[model samples]
Target: MSERVMPGRADGLITLDAADALWVDLTADSAVPTASAAFTCSPAHARAGYVLLGSRVVATVKASGGQWSVLETEVRRAAAELNAVRMDRQDLVRIGPFRGAPKKERNETTLLRWRQRITRELQELGESERAVRREGGGPSHLAGIDWRRILVERTRDRTARTWWLPRAVVRLLDVAEHTETRWVQAARTCQENTAVPEPPSHPRQARDAGGRQTTSPKGPGASLRPYNGELEGQLYSVLSGKPGTSRRVAGWVCAVCRTAPATVLDHCHEHGYVRAPVCQSCNTLERPDHLYSNDIRVANHYARLFDTDTDDWLRHWHRCPGCRARTTLPLPHLAAWTAHIACRSLRPTHHAPRGRKPCGVLRVSWTGSQNAPRSCLLTVAVDFCPSGEHRVLARVPYREAVERFRIWLAETAPAVAAAAGPDRLDGLPAQFRPVIADTSGEGLALF
Candidate 1:
């Protein structure tokens, strides 16, 4: 009998009749044949096949060779242009539905016209109301805004509720135009124009609302008089040189204390201005007359002490014990850490004397990043001692303090942690952790 060989890793031989039987067999136990021969299906076809299995295909696009790339490029470019137009129109309708017509003329009639115009534009761009209404993917930042509010309201009835862009449909119009959401754009624009003073080309005395020239006897205005021209010119130059600085400064999220959006533009009351913005808490905590108030050195100082990142003024900069003495010294890590733990334990008195000072003393001081932009000064001190008097001990720059703490913890924490018992892990905040045995001599491995 003649033997037939099956391709690939198959049993030795089979008769033609047996091969035909194998091909015809559809039993669950039968092995399916596999081959890497030329596949007639292209990647596009395979993708299409998978997509066809789905309920809906958003867009059915066909492209061949170089035309595909060109089409893609054109689509993207056209899309971007359309998005810009849509957003600008949306903003226009949002802020002024009357399209700069007199305020008295703005009413439901004008709003209907504006909506019709937008709808026509969308249709011309080959987009339908259904497409515009479809929810696109992204995070929504405005918590207070209800976009569904009327786009235009009658001037007389504006007191109860005013007009806003139609939210349900318009918000879904273009999700990508979100740099300045319509909800906050007006507030942001107002803040930018008014929050920071614009220097006049020529030094004219700043006037109050009554047209009387305002005087600042003890404030920034006092220093502005003598060098008004020079200062004003410099201020203009600085502000203009860095165009983004104003926006960044105004939009600053407080780096100090990790607080929410910073409202105050921090500056040197004496030197005029610095670029960084600080939260209300950090800005108000220190006396304005203090040396570090306008200096980045102050920011660096506190960051080092707490092993935190520094980009602005520290809230506790005034807490430096050596500020009065004008000299600071290094505090041992062991003593500083002990004092930290002790300070954490002390609670505030409910009805204590109103003017009583807290029980704490500065023991250590350090300065890091000197002569550099990032230069920082750090001071560590003990608070809540048994004796009424708080004594100054040592001070080191924040960087050194961090290293000292890390080293001390690494060296001493293992034994201490072992002594903490199994209960050491319980009732502790996520940040507080017992020392591990594998601590390095270089520093505390964990924060």
Candidate 2:
């Protein structure tokens, strides 16, 4: 693809390829991280003149411009600088927080503390939300946001539950964004902006749990600062530069082959996600590609011989070209082996019992790709009594399946755990097979 440059600024250009791009205007006032830095995105969107945040992470730093240690030091330096900014004597005009009448009736110090923490949190978030500004009619630092104007905007947003995260995460990101704004604002701190001297960063006196300084800002305000790489690159990637195109998953599954899962992933052992998974031949270099085909053929050959009973004998099949070349290849189960193998999962793939409740969920990950005929990029989760019938509760993204399973373990397993706890169903993973396929999208396949 070719670049089409417009006039003046470092942003605002079209792709000759007419690609969907993120337009960032770096010529305006904003900080841009170096190209070598690795980054991820945050789910922050604008609606009703507000930024909507997603349930999970906004972005993550895949890498940085320098060595890991160097990045750490820069963060330290930034923290120390921001911490030094004296908040003394600046009339702290806190807003957006109010105690309900019930709280007033109860009059609790515990509630008082919670309210204070929230106030500080809002203060920090306000600082961050106002960090980036448009550069119209030439340039101006942060679009000259007057604190007074910001308070007005914030007040408008405070009618109800209006931030973009769960209370805990909102509080956390608020601290991060605030710290960043404080630092960036400090970088551009100059004369002629009306003399109210912005709160400058201080040299950190001591490092904390995050390797940040003790002298750094505290509470929600501290977190709101730009401490992580994800927050740091926001304005640059979203505002001033053209980020790369949508990353579609690679096409690993081949349609013509008619494999169970068209895509076969070369998943690295010990890795959480399926960055890759090796094919049979790739799995064992000495094992020729033909071996796979042979295995499939043998399985299919036996499947055709099945009498379906006492000869209730179960048989599998595979018609892979790689193994077809070698008749003596290892006997194999065909494309449906996964589902066939996991046939036991179908036992209680229905509703749970009344009242008492069901056990935890099951998590399955199909390490495959779209192009691979045998690719089953999927996961299955079952909820039920750990030692009893398995109940099919929900099928969700693999990531979520993991979380739900974890939560189930925490909540329902106590009784079963308390009694013969050590005999818990923890080691059952080895026996459990992934549900391969279902004509109804509800049935988990057992090979």
Candidate 3:
């Protein structure tokens, strides 16, 4: 019976008779079929390499010369055309039989497997490309040999040529071009050395005290110290207690500075006991063990903690500008009064009112009990005004007063020394002379 020829669809789905016509059109230009002409035919016709008449698969008729070669050439041309079209439309290029999902969607295991497959494919392609290049051939020769190019050639529709192997691998894996190139080079190096490429190193997991690896709480480079559950629970108990200790502590000001709010829990490191709460700076600086070893006054201060009649160490005496009497000031008020003393001390000694003699001078005195006499009381007075009024600025504890003075001197000593010349250095206290000596040539001459 004569076979009935069905009409083809507009979407390139051709009937058995149309498939035969396509084969004839493909091979008419030459004795052998061309990949371009084969590609021009419907995908169904190219893929099948035969016409489907009802249930029977009927292969195309052979060309005139070299019948077996003609048949093989036709099948090959059809496959190349079919593969190029598939490569253009495929969402993920196939590596062997396995095609992976997008990188974001894949699990670790699947991603690792895909990476291995891609590396192997790259290594194989490199070997093939090198072999071709050594035989006076190039990428055109690799179109048939390099499966990666065959699987990932997007430019086939425009130029009818495959991309470079590394570029093709990049498109196939949906990776950066340089990343694929690195992989290719690594694979080639491994192949040359006859060794398998090492897998990429994952980020190191943080370990606890027990040496068990644990995921870091704050990602990579986070501290490895384990969270103390019991300590945290104890903290929560203290904070949520009936007396509201946290709120009470929040209300209290820094014990040391007495101005800033106390935010840190100060502790005696040697005795392993809690002490008064203080600000961050006071907490950091108040190392009793180190301070007591170096400073006699600090040792005395700590030793006096047990005494029933403890001296008022924080109390400071200053001549009040309004009262004109030595009035007691708190620690904060004393700090301000001492700052005022430093400001007056830094002023140029040569500067005075017109027609007034420059007899302005600063006077400092120290006082303490005979037993603990390390100059605990520091009294600073200045007589700089035209009236020659001897005004007592502050009578604060020596240590804190000296510390504040040192800070002020470091900033203003150069300007003061330069303006006042050699005579200024001669009048300064012996201890302060060294600081001025470093900043001025006239001060240096005193040595």
Candidate 4:
């Protein structure tokens, strides 16, 4: 209105100057070609002010700051309103322009829209049906989102708004450097809470290859190496405390086996005192709970199972009743053989050892043929007491003795035969399986 030409909306130049608060250079020709404006008359205008919006400037003055304060308050109100409008527009664009709802109300709506877009993209990729069933935060959902597409879209949208996603991640990582200290502290705390304590070992100082002394953890055996005299005195005291135990030399053989060298200072685990010095083999069995009272028996049992030199074992330990009675045959066969031997014993009719009369006499004999050496006739007879009545139990070939014995066993001692269970031959070595036509009656019959 003042006839000073204004800059056109399309092409104009705006500038600030020391003499003038505001100025505009116009591109379109006008009546007044040069334009300048001053917001205040004072060289240093502190209270007086102006509002510049693009090429327009609204100037104001006040008496002692009264009117200027009112104008300033109004300017602030207008500014807040403009900022709110901008933020609201940005919010609409962030979600959807057509949503016509606040960010809080539209958050789910926007999520649903993205979810649908992701689902469609995954379908285009020909993913399996399970992809849809996966949770929204799962790898399948992550794959469906297409991060490249998201980045591109975000960049495109930011370009439209004349802004950008700054290097915020780099800036955040810089801040995270301080947070890394917490991780170190957490690791130390975890070790303190979860570490386990171990038993302390004796310290041994020894020279390393460099000849410098180094201390290492030593075990019980290592701790005992330098105390042989003290150990011997203790062993002597322990032996003297026991009524029957005797102190023996280092090269002394085991008291039990009398074969292996005595090495360990055997002690009762319960009593915590040495009983004797014994070999490793004897010490295993000579515990306080089941002490080797019969060392011969222990030696004999072990000799049967593990010892190869039987002649020495027989000379020393076989005098034991258990050793003398031990047999290679199975228990069932042994019982049967015992019964057969008792049945074959013969004595006077109505025989009495000193007080009682005998029940009967049983006779078992074999008559072999000259032509067939392996073939023989088995004869079994029983004689009743006092009446002197003779009755034949079985008369069969020796090869058929097993069957005859089984029949006689069932008749004579039915309980024993019944206890033997089913007739199945066993204990015959694998090599004998070929020579034996049948093993129907376990080794009880073969014997």
Worst 10 residues of 1 by lDDT: 49-58
If both were scored by lDDT, which would come out higher, candidate 1 or candidate 3?
Answer: 3
Off by over 4 Å in 1: 1-244, 251-260, 264-278, 282-358, 363-402, 405-447
Query: Which is the winner by lDDT between candidate 2 and candidate 3?
Result: 3
Model 4 lDDT, residue 272, Cα:
26
How high a TM-score does candidate 2 get?
A: 0.19
Each candidate's clash count:
21, 70, 0, 3
Model 4 agreement with the true structure over 1-447: per-residue lDDT tens digits: 123323331112111231122222221122111113222221212232332211112223222323221122222332332223211111111211112222233232122222233324443443354345332332221111112212212334543311111122111111222122222233345446545422111132322223333222222121111112222213223454564333232335544455344445543221122334444344433221111111111111232322343333222221221212221121112222322443334434354678655355444444543124266454545556455466655554543544444565456445434544333223322222111111111111100
Ranking by TM-score: 1, 2, 3, 4
The CA lDDT at 183 in model 2 is: 37
lDDT agreement of model 2 with the native: 0.24
lDDT of 3 at 275: 42
Off by over 4 Å in 4: 1-374, 379-396, 399-401, 408-447
Model 2: residues >4 Å from true position, as ranges? 1-172, 179-188, 191-358, 377-379, 387-447
Cα miss at 259, model 2 (Å)? 46
> What tens digits encode model 2's per-residue C-alpha lDDT throughout 1-447?
114333321121122111111112121121211111111111111111111111111111111232111122222233233233322222222223433311223332111122233344444455445353211221111111111212222335555532211222222233333333333343344323535432222333332224433232222122221111221112111221233211110112112111111112221111111222122112222111122221111122122222122011110001211111111111122222222223234423335575433234332334442223243233333434465544433333333333333343335333322232223333223331222221111111100
Give the per-residue lDDT digits (tens) of candidate 1, residues 1-447: 113223321112222232223222311121211111101111112111111000011111212221110111222232233233222222222323323232223232221222334333333433254245434322111111112222344354643322335322233322211211221343244446665532121012333223333211121111211111211112222553565654444344444444233434433222222324444334433222122322221221232344432112222221122210111112222223423432334423223477644454334333433222146554544435555344333344445544454444334344322332334333223341222211111111110
Model 2 residue 85 distance off true place after TM-score fit, in angstroms: 27
- The alpha-carbon deviation from the true structure for residue 91 of candidate 2, after best TM-score superposition, in angstroms, is 35
Off by over 4 Å in 3: 1-214, 218-336, 339-378, 381-447
Candidate order (lDDT): 3, 4, 1, 2
lDDT of 4 at 437: 17
